[model samples]
Target: MAGAGEPGREGSGQEPLLVFRTMMRRLRAECPWKREQTHRSLSRYLLEEAHETLEAVDALAAAEDAGDPRRRDAAASHLREELGDLLLQVYFHAAVAEEHGDFDLDDVASGLAEKMVRRNPHVFGPDPVAHDDATSVDDAWQRIKAEERPRAALLDGVPATLPALLLADKALDRLARAGRPVEDLDPDDLGDRLLGLVAEARAAGADPEQALRDAVRRRV
Candidate 1:
């Protein structure tokens, strides 16, 4: 009694969505190893796939620089494949969540949608953003975020697990968003400070994070 719309059929059944469900079912049924996976076990695979995707993006940029049409096309295909791998990781994670009865892909999607709507009041609601200085827009966004989270510490939102360079960038961005007077520091002085810190890190064989954290702790 298989219908056209059914999986492997023509009509009269629920249309088989070739999406997360199909992938999940295939993983659960056909893939014995995929069925045995837990979130903790799959974390490394997810990170590896993400890094591969980043590599593909970097390759695409390099191909663009060379102006090779064939390389560019190949890079694009690689990028798409890498992205699909990343999407699979997302679905795999969602499947794990579904097993736990916590939340699934729909919840993840809905939560992101809600967060986007909440954050982008200008885009989604009546209060459209006015044309202003970049600093002003950033300040307004931070203010909105602060109102939403109401964190005790200013650095609460920055992910601690981010790479050191990215973490430092986020920290600086947060400070800038809060209207800190970085303009007061001379460009030469800033350059010198950064160079001196790099030299010190090289000399001491110390992590820049440790040095930066110590300095922040002393000041704060």
Candidate 2:
């Protein structure tokens, strides 16, 4: 039996997206500051938004750990604001590209959806050697990624601009997955062991940066 109203209760379900796109276009044309900006000029704002979002995530994580509903709600509210700021940066970029007749938000979204379907063959296409193990999925994902983009080196895409710790984590993970050999550097002390611990965390499907950040928040 069908529900009330129309067969499709929602009226096209694209009105909100259309509204957002219209708003972005109007802002691009009418706003003086927005009119003057280019994608290169907005790069810093994108980075700033990303860092603010991460800060909010950290705060939310800490609040969740403390088991305080009030604090959690407050953090969630702040996080939502940060996410909106971040999303605006994305839409702003899309609007800028659209002005030049290059591409728009739809192109960005379509490319991402296409990439996800291509990479996650197990879920979108066929369940190739299905297993609940995360490591297996990760391994297959890396292999498929390598095939999708032929890299000159295993570390080709590991951006040097990434924070030092994150770059290390990526390099380690890529080398390990690619079966590339690394020089056996001896761990001489406690600091070296901490480096090894980061690798262990990656192997266990944990984010070392977030883990340390959470630990600091909990303890200090």
Candidate 3:
């Protein structure tokens, strides 16, 4: 006999997730502010949480590089908390969608699982190919992703809202992957010069975004 609040009641031993899901559902039902939120209203929070999570990750990495065990441990805990906050944004969005009859959290998770399985044929598909390195696996993943969107226009998937340096980096990378050549831009134009710098960073195996952030941090 299944009892209320039993672990078995939550499928597959995901009791914590189920409990949080229930909490979100209840919040949406009972909280006046939560009840009034639309997807548009919640969008800013999702971006803020994502950036907070990234900051947490950078803190952890910095702590590790400094070889401070105590700082690393604290940073690790902070990162975990930030990750949970980011995850709550997902649940919040899913809750909103569930109310609108769009989709539930389970549908969102299932779609992500299906996409991962489809993209990593070297691991999930039959007769798995032995990838020589991470680069090979990544190449295969990118190739499969491109193949899936055969009719998509060039630059179709790149989000325009990305930071200028990162946006230029991704655009150049996408063109390179597609075997398309970009025409040289006017050297005198500041924006074009910055784009050229992004291309240089890529050729040098550096992240232009991280490099710029680090430069600013050093100056500060």
Q: What is the lDDT of residue 137 in candidate 3?
A: 94
Candidate 1 local Cα displacement, residue 116, angstroms: 1.4
lDDT of 2 by residue, 1-220 (tens): 3344332333345575566777778778878999999999999999999999999999998899889999999999999999999999989999999889999999999999999988788788876466588777887788888888899976787788987567768888877767763445568876567667778887787888778777776787
Instruction: Name the candidate that leads on lDDT.
Output: 3
Superior by lDDT: candidate 2 or candidate 3: 3
lDDT of 1 at 14: 42
How does each model score on TM-score? 0.70, 0.84, 0.89
lDDT of every predicted structure (CA atoms) = 0.72, 0.82, 0.87
TM-score winner between candidates 2 and 3: 3
Cα lDDT for residue 167, candidate 3: 87
| Pairs with steric clashes in candidate 2 | none
TM-score, candidate number 3: 0.89
TM-score (C-alpha, index-matched) for candidate 1: 0.70
The worst-scoring run of ten residues by lDDT in candidate 2 lies at 2-11
